[model samples]
Target: MLKTESLPVLMLMGPTASGKTQLAMDLYDSFPIEIISVDSALIYQGMDIGTAKPTSAEQAAYPHHLIDILSPSETYSAAEFVTDARKLIKDTHHKGKIPLLVGGTMLYFKALLEGLSPLPKADEHLRAQILEKALEQGWPALHGFLKQVDPKTAQRLHENDGQRISRALEVYYLTDKPLSLLQEEKGPCWDYPTLQFALLPEDRGWLHERIARRFELMLEQGFIAEVESLMRRGDLSIDMPSMRSVGYRQAWEYLEGKCDKETFIFKGIAATRQLAKRQITWLRSWQGARLIDCQRSQSLSQRVILDLRSQIEKYPIFM
Candidate 1:
């Protein structure tokens, strides 16, 4: 009843605790689409509770890809995700199914959508030297260094965004090239005709309240204990990407005795709120994304399904 030419790949994106998983499952029930996770943390093994990974039953019913595909000890990069995701998309299409990319990591979405810029791989020696300098000279000096070299990028990043600022400075210091230049040089390629959706609440306070409640739930769900297991592994350092996760970082502090249990939960909630704020800021910049308002809806899940149904009807994936 419909043409295959108009069946665009769908990307369902949202912040953590914004019901992306629920919405994706609802869509899965009605459509022949495989859920491909876009979250960075969900890729790791033994990180189920904190990451809010799908249960065995849910995954079995839905057939999600890119979850529990690796261990926390193994580092998975955005480059690898893009490569694997592209392969999955092609393979799924070949099998007469659509690919539905879903999750919270905006960078992963950017990697798949715009294509990765050809920046040199991180130089460990240079990164270490930069880290040492920052540790000795403080984060402000790193920010000043970045300002001197790549002022445009510096202006966009805040002084307190020490991680990104330090990384940007290190890249320039190592390669004598601005990271922005790499992005600009590699023009964006639309890899797929994509339909994007974001689940959001019209009221900010409602979403914030949801975030607070969810953080409480994570604590009850033994989030700290999960992080304890990872710390005991003795493989992760502060420099590792895994250390930068929301609840994981707080739990690390608790393990170090830098913060108590209360502080851990408090800081985790605060950090999650900050993360949601950043996600909202990024989502606003997305082009042509259909935003479903979750506020004032008695059944948020049903609303999402109806929206997806409308989109699928307009651009049917199966001919």
Candidate 2:
């Protein structure tokens, strides 16, 4: 049996389309590490094209944990991710390998690295009801509604943040308590050393251009047909967390005849850009993570491998 000892975990974080997966594959070829996907979208089955999921061949060769582990109809939580990832990390270490978590899901990364505050589970029915109310009344009006029940949370979240607002309301209704108050309680923290790295885009224009191109490619890859098959399942709705994902949401609306194909493409690209922007903003405030300007990095594989070798040697993980 492997002795109980400190093992370093490696994380490669970046916004979508920042070449994270390619770089990760290169690193995997050289390193003794097991990959655990940190992406929320990749957890669902039948969500390949739009989620930019690795191909069957790639997955077969690479063997990522936590991909396609759940149907899109079910929901996942950051707490659950922490639990699952901790186990995977331990399991990998037991085999004398490092755990290399790779993806753009910063929320999962945060939950794993710094831990989370306990909160009530999501009630889809309540979420749909809250969202229906928001549709009838503008998000600001719903923000006002949230203000009455959870003033602290409302103040923290912008009036235009419909998703968070709806979630806060759902929590309040479910537990008959304020979401803000619940968030004040502490939760479990990870007990391992970690070396976190991020591929940050220094050129906004380049990242935006990449997003546009990737969106177009996804369309060519039959993103619509993928969503169409999910719709045919007769168990999904637009409000489900799975369908609410960036490209999938727009395609769902387009198939429902709410918008033309051209408009759908425009909106899909715009939404993806917004998601990338949010991810970049979040990464900017993160502390202690080595940032790589992927837009300008040269011989990225060599540089990153050297850095990892030097750093992981300190932990004696890959030594």
Whole-model lDDT, candidate 1? 0.80
TM-score of each: 0.79, 0.83
User: Which portions of model 1 miss their true places by more than 4 Å?
Assistant: 1-7, 126-181, 314-319
Model 2 scores worst on lDDT over the 10 consecutive residues at 1-10
lDDT of 2 at 169: 85
Task: Report the C-alpha lDDT of model 2 over 38-112, residue by residue, as the tens digit.
Answer: 999999999999999999999888889999999999999999998899889988998888889999988998888
Q: lDDT scores for all predictions?
A: 0.80, 0.88
How well is each residue in 1-319 modelled by candidate 1, as lDDT tens digits? Answer: 4333345688988877888888788878778888899989888888877788898898888878999888777788887888888778877776677889999898898888878876667778877888898789888888887888898888899887878987788778767898777667654465567888887778888888988898788778888788888888888765567677777888888889998888878898888889988988889888778887756446876766676676667543453
The candidate scoring highest on TM-score is 2
Q: Cα RMSD (Å) per model?
A: 5.0, 4.8
